[model samples]
Each structure stands twice: as structure tokens, then as C-alpha cells.
Target: MTDHKEAITILGKTIHLGESKELSFEVAKLHTFNSVEVPVFIERAKKPGPTILLTAGIHGDEVNGVEIVRQIIEKGINKPKRGTIICIPVLNVFGFINLSREFPDGRDLNRVFPGTLKGSLASRVAYKLIQEIVQEVDFVMDFHTGGSGRFNAPQIRIIKGSKTLDQLATKFGAPFVLYSKNLNKSFRNTCHKLGKPILLFEGGKSFHIDNNVTIHGVNGIKRVLHSLGMLATKFKISTPKTDCVFINESKWIRAKYSGMFKATTPIGSFVTKGDFIGNITDPYGKFNHFVKADNTGYIINVNELPIVYQGDALFHISKELL
Candidate 1:
């Protein structure tokens, strides 16, 4: 049903942006009430080739990725040489509207992939996304941020067993390439199962945009596109050669008791199994508890807030060694 002559169409209409193009994409209705219409932007070449999909707002609070995709399209880099690039800047439109992390029905869209036609709100959205975007693409790069009450080191997540994804991860130019062997029912997992390598860029926190992270992410995506032969650009410099750590095991340090907490370890700091990381203290300093590391690794992520509750995750410790 694809015609090379009609390179661009939106909602069954041929849209001519002179230089910029837009399309109205749709997601299924929630509770059988209303459908969510989304915007899709593309820059196509007259010649046909591979298709790349760029998606963000999977978690509504991850605003940096949304802005990064918008800026990339708005800037209009070197035109595609052999294929097309489709950017879905916002995927979870309903969660994005309320600045929430989950769908209105409290479902996580990322957890439900290749969803059902007769399912919950999150499942329906997943089905529509996979149907409209995933099935038609050769490559995918989904963007994300930290989850609720968490912060992440700038990293890319790639499936561990694939040589193609491993090389693609380095092409992204991120400092850390997190080898996520979990393979949960995530978008990346589903795409990998279907033979499409997807790279996930995780940076900063939710509901806020970090300029540095955004710039790095955009640059990384462009670099990958160029590597994939989709864009014509001179390779100015070789990608930084960093040994990827296979992190198969990690744990979260939680508060032993509820109190005002103070952190002593900074992110990316190395630690031993029994090192004191922080403390919980009463207002009058009458009762104090010391938080210590239970594993030998680096502090890849930690809580930024001083206030905490019992069983609250305070730090994420993982080893990037082997």
C-alpha cells in the first residue's frame, strides 16, 4: 500500500510542509470513551530504504527525550540518503497530559507490549504503538527517564545477547551502555524478539529537562543514524571506546527506619560491602541510624531527597565489572 510517489501522508491527506511534514496518528480509546490522536513527523527520501522509529514519552514525566526528538526534527539535519525516519515524540499522550508516570488506570505501558485488542487502557495503547510504528520499522530508539522517586546515570540499555545491538549501543556515544539482560515485556525486548535492534536512552529525572542530557541524546541518535547508512554525514571523530560492563545483579538500599535522612555518597562513587553510606537522624539528634552498603560496587544511583520512609529505596548499587 506504499507508493514512492506519495512520500508523505497524514490522516489520509498528502501534507506538504515545504521542508517540515506532520501526520495525525491515532491510539485506541480508553474505557471505550475516546481515542488518543498523536502527532508523527517524518523526513523521507525519494529512494526507499530502511525505516527508523524514534519514540519518547513512554513514561509521561520523561520530558527531556520529548524535547530532544522535537529539536532533532525541527533542526532538520542532513537529509536521509537511503531511507525514512519517523519520530513519535510523545507516545503516552494521556499520561503526558497529566505529567504522570502511568496511564490513567494506573497501568505501566512499557510493561505491556504487543498488546491485545480487547484489553486495558495501557494494553490498547501498546497494541496501537506496535501496530502503527513497530511493525513498519527497521530500527527503533525509545527514550526514557528515571522512574518514580529515582534518578539515573545517563546510559543506553541494549539486549545482551545480540552482536548487532551491542555495536549499535556503542554508536550511540553514551558514556554508559547498561546491558539489560532482564528482557521484561518492554518495548525494547519485544522489538529485539522481532529482530529489530532498539536502543533505550535513559537520562536525568522525571518532569524536568536537563539541557546537557538532551544535547547528548540528540547527538547520539544522529550518530547512530549515520552509522546505519540512513544519513550522509562525515565521521568527524571515532566514538569513545569504553568497555561495557555486564551488570547482571544489583540491589537497592532501603531505609531501616523512617526519619530525616542524609546521603554521604555521591552517584558513581565506589564502595565496599560494609561502607557507611548515609544516616537517619531524629529531629533532636536523639536517635540515629547509619545506612551502610551491603555489596561491593559503585553508587550508580541514589535518592536526591532527604526525607524518607521505612522500606524506601535510598540507593541503587551495581557493579559495572564483568
Candidate 2:
């Protein structure tokens, strides 16, 4: 990054063995007519092995994901010992440029999969990715962060009942692994349909980069590469601080009333049923409503936004564990 020897063709460029190249493909242009190209970084090892593709920034505001990929490139982690490593730090260039979550056309890139040739901009880009890049990689690792003001504890998401994914998620060693069904038309679903094993990582929140989340992400990548024998000898793998938890089910704690909300509980912590965890208050000297835990489970996500409304998701708590 695969079904080839000595060389691989990406965007019509033939990259031979042990050769590293920065190639890009044109997607669209700005209003000024300047061409916009999405860069693809490729690094191949002299000895042949499986190819792994690392990607992020499908949602432009998820800068933390972009940072993780950027660190891989910056630290030469993309240089594999025996296999090919491809890093696409930013998949949605338009969204990244505008610091927005969706494409310029207001379409979510993750919702379009195996896109059509003559579709919307995001769809076209998705199609190109599948046809040109996804077909070449043996495996994939996509990075993401929470949307809105929600901050997520480092975690991996995969469909339930996959032994292979369970092993990989354990190897990833994030604090939590949540079993979830794949969304229709999602990239993960498309890749799974094509027989590609992919890991989806979610952490932190949009527009903000947290140190702990970044370290977890980078370490997870190194662990996966090391498992494949692709990690460089110079890089040392770090042991995870704690055993990863497998979540079989989870529920969102929604706001009961609209007000300025503040969470007293931290992410990734367990709480008993009806425990006081947060509060809601008005700007003026008004009544303060104390929020309680819905059940006894780990809080995986917390909405950090100060303002809230009725029915707003406040926290994500595990409902069942494996």
C-alpha cells in the first residue's frame, strides 16, 4: 500500500520496491480555479509483506485524528520494516481547509461509500479512494474524534462477533472497545464488504487535541505495526497502563431540561445508579438541578459544551460489558 510484487500503481504512478514517494490526486478546485490535490504518502519496504493504510480527517474538524497521522509521518513511523505503509493524513481536503465537519456541499464524507462516478463531490472522492487506494491495501486503520463538544475516551469500534477484530482491538490496547454495528454506506462497511480488515479509532473531541488521546492513538498504531513485524527496530513498544475493557452495549444520557450544564464526572470512570454526577443551572440566580447517573457503568463520553437543551446527549455510558 497489494496484490502485486516489486511495484504498485497509485494514481497512475508506479512505485517500485523500497522507493518512497509523495503522490497526490486531483479532487476539485477552489472558487479561484486553483487545483486542489489530496496528498498520499507511500513507503515500501525492501522485503515484501502485507500493506497497511492509515487514514484520518474524514471529518475536517477532527484535528486530533489528523495529528495522529501527522506524527506517524513526522516520526518516520510510516517506514515499515517488511511491508508497505500508506498514510493519508487528510482525506477530506475541502472540509479540512474550511475546518468544517462536512464537505463544501454539506455532505458527510463517511456516509458515502463505494461512490458513483458521476455523483456529488464527496461521493466522487469516496469512489476514487475505493478504486485507487482501498483496492491496494491489505488492511486499514481509520482515526476519528467525537463530534460537537463531546469528548470521548480512547476507544476502538468494531462490529460484534468478529474474533479477528477482537484480537486486533485487544492488540490496539485502547481504554475501551465498543462493539457496534456498521452504518450503511460507511467506509468501514464498504471495506469489510471487500474483505479488508479495518480498525476504527475514536477519541477526544473535534477542534481540540488532547495529549492522552494522541499518545494512545500513536501507541496503538505502533503496536499494530509491531504485531505485523513492520515496526522499525529502533521503535520500542510501550505496555498499556491498564487492561482494555470490552463494551457490549451502551446508552446515551440525555439532558432532562435545557440549561447551562456542567459534568462533575470524568470520562472513562464508573458510577453507581443515581449517583450525583453533574448539574444544570441558569445564567441568573435560578434553580440548580443535580444530574444523576443512569446506571452503574463506565462513562465513555462527556459533552463538554456549556449550553444544553432538552433531549441533548450529555454522556455515553456502557450498558453491558464483555
User: Clashes in each model (backbone N, CA, C under 3 Å)?
Assistant: 0, 0
How far in Å is the alpha carbon of 233 misplaced in model 2?
A: 0.3
Residue pairs with clashing backbones, model 1:
none
TM-score, cand. 1: 0.84
- Evaluate residue 173 in candidate 2 and report its C-alpha lDDT on the 0 to 100 scale: 94
* lDDT for each residue of candidate 2 in 7-103, tens digit (9 for 90 to 100): 8878778888799999987888778999989899999999888889999999999999999999999999999998799999999888888899999
Residue 89's lDDT within candidate 1 is: 91
Q: Residue 270's C-alpha lDDT in candidate 1? A: 78
The local distance difference test score of model 2 is 0.92
Tell me the tens digit of each residue's lDDT in model 1 across 1-322: 1223334443455533223457767775557787678888877776666668889998887888898888877776435655677788998888799998888879888898878877987887787677756776678888988766566666788766778877887778776676666357788778877777788888877888878778768878887877867665543434544544445457889999998988888766779999999999888879999999999987766776678899999988885555
The whole-model lDDT of each prediction reads 0.75, 0.92
**lDDT: which candidate is best?**
2
